[model samples]
Target: MVERKLFAGHAVRRLRRTLALTQAAMAEALDVSPSYLNLIERNQRPLTATLMLRLAETYDFDPRNLGASEPGGGSDAIRRRLADPMFADLEVDRAQVEEWLAGAPGGAEAFARAYDRMGQGGAASDGAPDPASAVRREIERWRNHFADLDAAAEALADELRQGSGDLYSAMAERLRVRHQMSVRILPVEVMPDLLKRIDLHARQVQLSESLEPASRSFALAERLAQEAQGEIEALVRGAGLDRLGERLYRRHLTGYFAAALMMPYARFLRACEATGHDVELLMRRFGATWEQVAHRLTTLQRVGARGLPFFMLRTDRAGQVSKRYAGASGSPLADAPGLCPLWGAFDAFERQGDVAVQLAELEDGSRWLTLARVVQPQGARAGGVRARFAVVLGLSASDAATLASARGLDLRGVAVPIGLGCRACTRPDCPQRSAAPGGRARLVNDRETGLSPFGFAGD
Candidate 1:
């Protein structure tokens, strides 16, 4: 048997920089010569098991993280980026991509960022930033968790004495007593175009009667999040967003605060574990909607008592993604331009109100346990038409044992092959291929057609 050498120089260098330690200092701490440390940092020497143990003991670092790739600098991301038509003539190979990532992860990350910006239509001609992309990146950077907001919300939840009575009533009482505000459930006819409205003169937070109990409670929580304006505003100011992006980020933070208040991190995590992450059970327990529960599940990133790191995506029938959070799962599907049609998110529309579970295998052979369910927005109705979306929550299939949703599944069976999207997917035999792969040349024949509509020459 051959042993695989761990050449994680980039990770070591990054760790050293993060600790603000010079190479000599780190080498001294590791009880290694400076020349040997230099060789290790240059990938000329492999990281030994003993050194890994030392690192864990000395720095309280997880050795497993050494094998982890930087965001957007992984070989898979590089390959996907190279699949773009713009790189067709480059002839870059997987080995080269891996080598680049290993040798200079920083440069690889810069390249990834440039490629992503180009994919997002590049920078504005007038030098203006794309606010939506900026906000998404900001959320991704935080891994969808705001510790300060979570702490504040948990404290506020305790103050409200949540378990003693209904949360909505408690929130309303708090508002009335502290803020001198009143809560009113107005008929839809009275506020035809609004779900929630705050009247300063009336000193009332008016909610449309169409809102469900959960939504009404959320509205009250949102209003209460304003009391934590200083915290949310501090995060917003540090986000480096322009006026529009700042506004959007502020709204996102407000929503985060509201969800945290509704679920209260410590208690919600306990419920999630006790129920095996049953979304419906959580909805009933927390007085939240299905979508809200799914969204909250993505934000369960508290340090010591963390739940499963789930990536979430909300898409419509047309396959348009309305919301996405990668969380800590690091699944490329969260960042894909288009989702695979074969994924259960699309199947969810066929079985509305039922959870559709899929053990989806991406082109890179990474398996994810996905739970998809169709949800109709609370007040999204017009002329008798209801707007619907599929909320898909996923985590690495290896964690299926901890996931109740994946119970009774055949983990060893042939998994459903999915991909990032048709454009970047390299699966030559996928019947559902909508577009020819980006860098492949079409193999046109007059006499025959393959299983796929678009056949291309193999690499």
Candidate 2:
């Protein structure tokens, strides 16, 4: 009997496209020649075991599918959707499904989304959580980085820049002069549940008195963003998307403008470089919150004056990632699902004010230095829900020497091994492993149990 070689050209192509890498770039990362990758993509050559392991190690790929031992297409999702009782009588063949997935991947994905939406509640899904999930997935698809908006924000910052002056006051002044708007800081009792509200008819903006100066200034900048809505909307229009897409874009734009106004690009970039990208110093200097400083740090991509490329991750106490930002130098941490419980982000909750520094080694053998600190949301004076989350700022291990925060620390010694998510991670000895991974078969032992709850096939 002869064994057949499996070809997964589509999956390889899809992974490369998801990473936004060119053939040459993807090939280099996979440690293969571009021509060889081309052959593999064309199904002219079978994806080898060595190449499969490389893909799993370097990227968020399932090792099981890399071998093509089972079905390796969108057929599974489509079949699952078709299996629903709503389509109980309908007949679909495996070949036809494969054909659709192979030829029309986007349509297949749309079908999945539509199927999901239908099951969740359809047109009535309005005001429901489905759109929020869709919006989040969309943001994740773009790695939470918007180039056009980032450029416009930098331009605004440059225009509003002053020599050793307060940027927030400058923004307020601009709003008053250009838009005929009055800014008022009202008492928290009067404002109550609202942090800021714009009375467009009255041409006045009211903010809560309970907020700190930074929060008040950010609220003012957001009002200014509304004043420039025409300009901002024009920029958003060119980006091109559906109604919901425009909403997400506008929300991001509002926040971007606020951050830019709070920490004008030129001055902030200079200060970041001078302070060796110190978060505390930046926060104190700009009168911004730790979350705001961390967010602004990810936007320091101004052509010749670019700061060190950084990625920001915000997670709640439960370890669910809520917000993420990837810089222009290319998002090495883009779509990174590794939420290792041991990450300092979780530890920050217990550590209180202290920022925890950690060195993380990924499955690919690449390393990053992560700084984690807890952030408490303001505007809680109204008895509103106050949510506290941890924000982690990560930079390449190579950039540690350039940072003052990591000064005098032995970068080589305290390194921790981490994986993506439990379902996707294959770390066998991880005592923190919560679930079995996809590629490996779970081994059940009635006789004895180990430190880790689950064991894989090899173990």
Candidate 3:
């Protein structure tokens, strides 16, 4: 096992800022000397396991944020910026950059912010202003677990489910009794464009009749979230997001609440551990769709009762990503555009029922065991063609043995090399090159045939 260190100086500083506590005050709370805390904040000392536990217990810190190389949000973007040719003469290394992130994350962010402002006025910039794409990149670049929202959802689950006769029934009862809102199963014709809708004027929550009982219950939970929207908004406010971002996070939290209500955290973790993270069995047990099960697998970041840190990717037939979730910051799956078409998720479209098991190696030599399959929309009428989407669930190579899908596979053998995307890919001999790499590339024709469609002249 590779040793994962705890270089969480930035996290500690962030926590202190959030609590509005001075170094001495935080030291007193953590039962550490002020000088020790100072050393930790300066990246001069690594946090011990005991101190890490204390930090979590005292401040309700999410354990995932304390990783040695945890992305400090702007650090990854800064690293990408530094990779530009403008900084080629500078002696910058990963270790130095990480230390800069740990010791002075705010300064790094200020630099990025200033650089972005300078780029807005027609100045030369490393990257361009693609806010829509940048939003997606920023959102998926890091995995931050908000413990306040999670605890709130878990508490609601505890209240709704008593002895667990039927979780759906319990939720329905809670909705009826507490909110006085009735759930009606309306036909698809009545609610054509949307899956669920709330009529505040009539105090009725309407769901599509074609949905299964589990889906209906989840829709009702989403309505309940609307009724209790204030609570979600409060959590979003505490999350330290901007005004626009808070609105987006509020919607995300509501979906999170629905999922948490469907499958309680403790029960879900127990089921995952018992079944070796089997997707099919979990779907059957939880009455969730394949996509729902896969997405939930990424959100199991509870400090004490955590499951496998699996990242999820869902893409359409055109290789455009519809949804992506990372278990933690700096996920390899978040790399964009040049995702090799050879990924098994795309293959799942051709081979419908069969699961595509792959041992994929990234450009950085990190390997992952991925299981992918296609899932169609549930309850499609007999005469109509259903929309199919591919979902891929993967984890680091070390966790391959723990997954049932990885069994009977030669994981140690040569694995397929995949890139971030076609534009960012650097593989010189890819047979499936749809386009050339990002920067300028010299053409090498010489009136001679080559294996690849586009060949760089220098090579």
Candidate 4:
């Protein structure tokens, strides 16, 4: 069932041994602890771009064979193995599990093997989940999106898939290959030739003579957008998923295709199934940063096939919502549009790029299997301008039933309130209201003596 393009977990582990370096020695050389080195060897931690570079420089290792793509199962097997019952008495946190996964890959395996034999006593299942059922569940979860898009894009992809106008055309074709849509990227060289003049009648775009590189790139994208308009519109129509907030939902779906193309659905779905949903494996398999993988997981609800229903969100350093891909169920974060004070775990990134996993209950009664990590994005080329991005992955309350982490609390009635602000939020106890939802209105001051941000009638 494993794809050839995917990097093998055991293969990577074997690479570490082939080098003749012990875990402790490698850890010392890498300026990381022994445990961390072990995790990378076991494919628990993504041999990240940073770690991959370091391994090559220090150990004369060739990580390219490990590739930007990776095979997913080895690590998932490791995780399920770790949950073995022999340690049923021993309590373990997911973060601690990840840290060990990151640093002591091989040792983690040994420990898991020991734990498995001692506890599980032959608990492994022989059969894989029915691929068809997985697909059907995914379709139902996504509400039947694939059929509609396939029906709509069939003709367009056939026609435009062969056209070779620009990078956008090429990018569109790439999308077609993956999603059967004629979507392609606009290359840098010819981006300037694209004109902004939109022909509404023919849906053709004429390029202006003066655009620079960035503008041309955008223009080509604009034209591609125009060319694919009918198809895109047809896709939305085809999706049987009814949404609570239709406008916002549509805008989000439009973004979904963009994100999906950036991280193709089939490649990603297969990888997740193979990796057993190991976040690190997905990251490595896609050559995407941790944030990208986190964002991608949320979009799995697209085609209604092969996906675990989940809500995924992300925040930045100042707690701004840099990205949120919450399909039918939107992100839980509120208060700040770009910056959210609510998602505090992302703050851990400044410490040492560690992954923090938690089962959190929002003010509203929602439970989440939250995985957070810090990531620094290198510029387009090597050593380009780098910016750190915080990534968070979340699954709804019910889906977290198997994880024994959350405290013994019935999360069914729990409510995590989310709103624009005090004026809009209607939560009277908020002390940090900077502005009212509407005009200058004053309400009760729960923290102070006189008034809150939405104070009683001008205070």
| Candidate with best lDDT | 1
**Candidate 2 residue lDDT tens string, 361-395:** 76556678889998887678545687889999988
- C-alpha RMSD of each candidate structure in angstroms: 5.1, 11.7, 4.8, 20.6
Candidate 3 per-residue lDDT, tens place, 242-335, comes to: 5565666666778877777677788888999889899999988988877788888888766566677788888888887877776552455643
Stretches of model 3 off by over 4 angstroms after superposition: 1-4, 14-38, 49-93, 110-144, 226-231, 239-244, 377-386, 457-459
The TM-score of candidate 1 is 0.83
* Candidate 1 local Cα displacement, residue 291, angstroms: 0.9
lDDT of 2 at 256: 79
Candidate 2's C-alpha lDDT? Answer: 0.69
Candidate 1 minimal-lDDT segment of 10 residues: 68-77
Decide which is better by TM-score, 3 or 4.
3
The most accurate candidate by TM-score is 1
- Candidate 1, residue 57: the lDDT equals 93
What value does the lDDT take at residue 302 in candidate 4? 35
Over all chains combined, what TM-score does candidate 3 have? 0.82
Ranking by lDDT: 1, 3, 2, 4
Give per-model TM-scores: 0.83, 0.68, 0.82, 0.39
